[model samples]
Target chain A: MVTTVNLTALRRDIASLSERNALEAQAPRSAFGFGDRSIDKVLGKGLQRGALHEVFAAQMHDAGAATGFVIALALRSSSDQSPIVWLEEDFAAQEHGFPYAPGLNHLGLDPQRLVIVRCSSPQDVLKAASDSLGIRGTGAVIIAPWSNPKCLDLTATRKLLLTAQQTGVPAFLLRLGAIPIDNSAVTRWMIRSNASRSSGANAPGHPVFDATLIRNRQGMTGHWILQWESDNHVFRQIEPVSGAVVSTPAHRPPQTRKSATG
Target chain B: MRLTALDERAAKAGLFKTMALTDARAQFENLDIAFASPRKDAALLEKLADWCDRYTPLVALDGADGLMLDITGCVHLFGDEHQLRRDIHQRLSQHGVVVRSAITGNAAAAHAFARHSAGDVIEDSALTQKLRRLRLVSLEIEDVHLAGLKRAGLRTIGDVEVLPRAALAARFGAGLVERLDALFGYAHHPISPRCVVPACMVERRMAEPLIVMDSVERVLHALGDELFRQLQQRVEGAREVEASFFRVDGEVRRIGIQAGRPLTDTKTLFRLLKERLSTLAEPLDAGYGFDIIRLAAVRAERTQTIQKSLDSTVQETEEIGGLIDRLSIRLGTGRVLRPHPVDTHIPERAVSLEPAVHTAANPPVEWAPVQHPGEPPERPVRLFQPPEQIETTAGIPDGAPAQFVWRRVRHTIVLAEGPERIAPEWWREHAGALTRDYYRLEDNRGHRFWVFREGLYERGQTTPRWYLHGLFA
Candidate 1:
């Protein structure tokens, strides 16, 4: 009689586990695409709407490009009528600069639709970001921390992720001057600035970025060179030019190449 | 040095104010003495006035040592005028303060009665008779005017009042006559209150002091309901609301909440207040508990009632506004801000961040276009307020830099865009400012920078300086 009861309990546990997996698979998740077919295909149609995505600058100088990429993602994921909340650390503002309204407008975001919260510390940024993400009507939240702060642990990121999932508002965590660390994010990206296609007479064209998917929960990681079309508010694949000559490094000597590569 | 003030013990020991320290010490070998600070005395008086807010909203500072409470319509709340005076004196005395108080038809008479005769509630019928018995010093005239009045055989207010016509004005220069009229209750003398009298007010007096937050919140909600009911009668809404907590021991704590729009909902007001109280730097110390809680609408505005609609857009706007209010209260109002575009050519001044609670009510302004249809952005994504100076080597004086060093990194220019000349606003205060020539440059590693050279080399200025103003995405 004891053996029979144990078997029945074991069967019930397996059945419940499978049922939970099935329910998770059946849940509907709406995603917004990057407009580039290649990138979207790898992302399984598009990026998930209500998930925490981490973006890191390859180097400190690439902060501007990383910021632009996040803003473009925010604009794409949410409607124009809904406001985007930006939580920035005071150190980051002092190191990089303040987000200029005209520059944000130049990136196709209405300056009026942006609400900014300037915090003195990373902990405050996290606190305000969590509060903003819990609200239902917020379009998206952008949290920018200057460097790797001790307060930003796995637990904090997980809390932010759970709040985002519950409220259906996407959150982007932008890290400048920091390397990729342990986080509970759906996707992680490393961004570097790419040379834009110069217009006539060596004039720089639209903004371009070399975005590397370092980690993806549901798909394989990939890299791509994407150009931002501000007028259309979408990211497009860079076109290949025929017979283009590669320019040599003017500042670094050839002997340093091996060490740099290593 | 001379003594500026004295306590009861020192006064009983024959040490009056303005007496020399040596003389006082000679009179008593070991008399306790302390140097007086008029500033501290004034501060203590101000605090006492704040505590007196429990009696009436029109409490004002009467000198460096006294408080004047105008209880015109508030006398009925505490039984009667005599009962109110007794309540004030008893409460203050329990706090270990030497108390003297009076109630009269006007502030000047009340001031005189309190200083001369400790406790008196004089009626209007006896105002003239009371004024006649007061001495000339009660009028608070200058020493020179007092001596002149004494030499003229004017020892009391009645002595001066009987002779006041055109002759008194000529001798006292119209000041003493004004003081005499004010004492007789003929001239108006209003006391300037410490706080603005709220448009609508409601209060709750608990028999038992409240120490728990739950009870405090309950009392706030009840007071909010009563305040809203009064506001609804006139079709008005509050823009700012203040809650004053009078502790059992003479301590007052005031918390104020400001809304983006005129607020009429009691639930919203309570929620905002709860957020503010929870996030305060120093939590409310309900030492001994609060006996009196008062809520007042300090600022109100006319609000038109709108019909409720089924559209989700209206509900969404309201939800967003509520979120803004909560965030503003939690993180101070100045921390949460909305970007406002200012019409100017300078990049930093073009956008000003105003507090979100204020800008939410005003219509959005038009932002100047910063990008062209087919070209890159004319402005950078992030701009430094005061541009950082950089070292650069331009191929020519009028051309863009070929190489530059910024923040200890050397960047070789791979591509460059021109000389978008933005001249200073010569029509304004920057008349002597030099014209700047800006360039958008891309380095070999592909980082873009917006750098400008201040002053033209051909304009007969000294060596031109280059600055990295912003970074492009």
Candidate 2:
């Protein structure tokens, strides 16, 4: 006599699975405004707001330029009432002399709101960033680990990204090299300076940038070929590249798993 | 000596009659006056005190035509007490002050004899007979007692000392009796100084004054070492150190440094002093170079040494601090700052930056709640020093513009997500007159935008423009 499995037990197992699925569906999806439109669509609407959004700028290895860009971005995102926390590593080049404060102020950003923590080493910077995540009134935290030797490590970076994700304030890391660490970050992008024709006599030129979302969540990975108008400091899609516009694949969230070690 | 004769001449004049005359220099704008007593010719006592400093730091006015010095440990350096007193009198006479010389077993007798006799060294054998010969005025009695003694026809100190002590007290009052006894060495008469001498002080009497900064620094280092050795005698570290330069002329410049903690290390103390000296707008100039360099400890405290770790990282931090100190010294204190956290919702008020002074303490930081714990307002990535106005066509009759021009560029909105109204902070009068309706709008060209409505629709103000404050990365 062959015994058959009980119908109620199978049904109960199915019910538990369904309940778990329902709970997972109810969990709020992390979202942040890309502060751009097309990029937001590709990025699942802004960087997961309150989540860690890491962009690995491989070609943009220049820390100063990257620092300037981050400063501009942080200034753009901050308000007079709430400011961004900048944890700086050992990037003490002569050019880095206290100019960031006044420069940010000149560009329609409040200089007083920028909290610059000058640490001796990158480890200290990461520690300060991790510490900043637990602090309220801190809208965004910009960390550059590669600039300081002590902070240039795998462990601290992972810990920092984890803290950023948990707290929701975006942590922008300036990528030092070409190969992106996909697992350690939610989003990894490579920003290459693309050339554009000068529009008019006085207007310097059109800034065209080729930013590839090399790694993305939700299967939305592709390149964003855009024109960066220098005057406005904005990026607009000129035309989508062939592999640039990949839609989210149905049935599961896209996983571009990257290792903790880069 | 030359000064003793001058003092004898001044003693005949009775110039320095009272303690009041000793401090008379403080009232005068110029202290370089020849002392002249209206009562007598004893105008040389003041000059004598000024000249005596050349001999030692300790000097005081004793009586009319007289100056007293302990000279206990110092006299031996000048060969003997007689030689030291002789040298002192000679120096005084050179500067035109009359002074009398007297040495005795005690200060009171010496003071009395100095005022009355010439070169009197009263031994124990002749003490009583010598006291009887002195006048009542030399007894340092009060005015009433002197008048009483003169009325009673006992006008001499000898007459007063020969009388019974009980009868003297009964007739002339106790003050008269006591002052007589004090003057006759029957009671103690302790002398107090104007300024107490520091326990440890080192002075460099430069034969040739130092004019160069490097030389001055070298002198300072040597002086600091000497001062440190003096401090070491008492097992105390200097909390406050002062370097004083006395020019050839009458100008004195003092640079002082007070440490956060008591420090005895010469190099560290020198470095701190260097920072302070660098910040001085006017460099101290020694016209003919500093003739006298003195390092004095104004305040001292017990110092406990902490065993320093041999860790290289700790050393590096110290090095960085030193570098910052140098930079801060070069820049104005207001220009170089350390960001300190402030407890406030407003970003501008959240952190206060201050100069990197060694004594400045780390301010209290409200570290908990790493979230949007304070005011949950939307902050800009870039904050304008002054919020710039963006011209937007969003507030037209139709409301929410399909296309708005910012920085003179036309970008059409593909999808817009807010009129998230952020009213101006009502309490602040300086907040601009704009009720922002912030919208995270994407342009038709796929550029994400941060645009805000400056005013309301069909309300008080017309032409509501949108500001482009920041861009998304």
Candidate 3:
């Protein structure tokens, strides 16, 4: 009787596991991959479409990097050439400068495909986000609020997520100088600027991001150092130089030992 | 000071306008007097003219105190001319305003009759005979001209009419003949309405005023349907639409919306109007309720009749257009913007944010590519307007900054690229302008910034100042 009971317990576990798998299969599986092998592996199939994703600047000064990362994601996730709507708050635009069209063109985004909705406040940003997310043919929606506002509560984000899911348009909430809080986003990311590999003459090269996946509802969290290849419109993993000589550490061994002792 | 005007009691006491205030007070010891403000009177007259729009769309201000309403073809709606005149008089009286109204075949005759002989509705055949009884002063001519006519012994319009036309023209000037002909209904003088007459309009007049918001929306929907049908019959669409609400208390409220494209769909039109009404800064006040609601296409354009296509792209375009219109109406048109490439080389002026509604109608602009293959972007992702000044320490007088202080934060420059010099446009009148040497800099913390040095290190000028212009990703 003990053997039979153990066998039944094992069968029940298998049954539940299979059921979960089946449910996951039935869920909307339309996703867009990041094209990077390792990042895509960590993201299962890739970032799910028609869901809410939050991107936070790791530091207040890294807002430019965070914005670039979000733009890359939007370009990757958009299924077609449909227009992308950007909901920007007035405070945010004043704090960080306005998005430049020539820069957007340099980043492989057509200026004509961008629709900017300048909202007066954080509340208006969320309102416009929800409106754009409900639109069927919209490529993507990026909601950039200045900072953590009281109106950006869990309830508001949940509403945005539900609307995005219903309309199959992905929504990205970009926060500058804000900490990650509990919300209904499918994925949460913290992004910071990474030192780009220098080209000839010690000049800064392509834009590089140190992106940390803080939360993922359906997959494992990971980190990456990504270099945006604007010409090809893809994110490439930053590879170490093949035959570069290593330089000495800036801090000497005696100084490091004294600090450690303290 | 002279008294500019008088009330009925003061007028009955033999006090005339332009009489000295002391004389008026002497005529009546316990006189009630208030200062007359012609400016305020003119403002009230303008408001009264707006209120009169409920009767006819053509309402113009006559002088400072009178309103000229051309009620042609509108009288039948209010039963007849006599009833229309009585209704206007009764309604205005209810508002505590004493109004004198007259209907005539022409505006000049009507103006004379209303001021000199109140409550006269003259037919086309009787306009001349009726106008002849009015005094020449009622013509509203210049004071000098009126004195000339009086010196010529023309006491009434009858005396002026009996004179020869050539003699009258030669003696008093051609203006008198023109005025006489206008009064006799021999010439037509159309009144310039204060508001633009709509290209097409449909209105609903209710016996009971509508106080509920839902009822107003329902009426708007029906009106939209009617308007769409009218537009469809003419193969036209509305570019600009206006909905006017006539309140029972003589308050006229109008809400206008502009479409990015020629809109022919009734549902989209209703949705846009509803969105605009809901987002109004001052919510619609239904004070005493609205008695008449009219929908008009102020600007209509001829549109091609296109067959419904099976292509999904066409349908998607239509849906997106509708969405743009809805958003523009909700959040003001200026808030909804798209990047428009300008023809200048100045970074800030390179891309201008234009209202999306207008830019959508324009052909897409060709943006010059500023990126180079296998290299980082030449331009920064975000550009600050009027670049912020920064303190910097440079190794050389003209070299890129070695370190910079921005926003009270010190950043050590690790790598930098440029000294791409941009000279100011000398063709334009920009005084005290200097050349700019820009550099792309990455700080030790990996934050990238675009900084510039204004003015070169020349011999006879102030030291060049450093400024942080943009942020790069």
Docking class of 1: medium
Q: Among all windows of ten consecutive residues in candidate 1 chain B, which has the lowest summed lDDT? A: B362-371
List, residue by residue over B151-216, the lDDT tens digit for candidate 1. Answer: 988888888888946998898778888877787788998889989999999999999999998899
Q: What is the TM-score of chain B alone in each candidate?
A: 0.95, 0.52, 0.90
- For each candidate in turn, the TM-score is 0.94, 0.40, 0.90
Please list the residue runs of candidate 1 whose C-alpha ends up more than 4 Å from where it truly belongs after superposition: A1-28, A240-246, A249-262, B303-308, B369-371, B427-432
Count the clashes in each prediction: 0, 52, 0
User: Considering every candidate listed, which one attains the maximal lDDT?
Assistant: 1
Model 3 chain B weakest 10-residue run by lDDT:
B362-371
Instruction: Write down the RMSD of all candidates, one decimal each.
Output: 2.9, 20.0, 4.3
TM-score of chain A of 1: 0.88
Q: Residue B350's C-alpha lDDT in candidate 1? A: 85
Candidate 3, backbone clash total? 0
lDDT of 2 by residue, B255-318 (tens): 7765544557689778778777866889788787877777778777675554678754444334
Best TM-score goes to which candidate?
1
Off by over 4 Å in 2: A1-262, B1-69, B98-111, B114-116, B119-132, B162-166, B184-190, B205-219, B230-235, B244-255, B272-292, B310-473
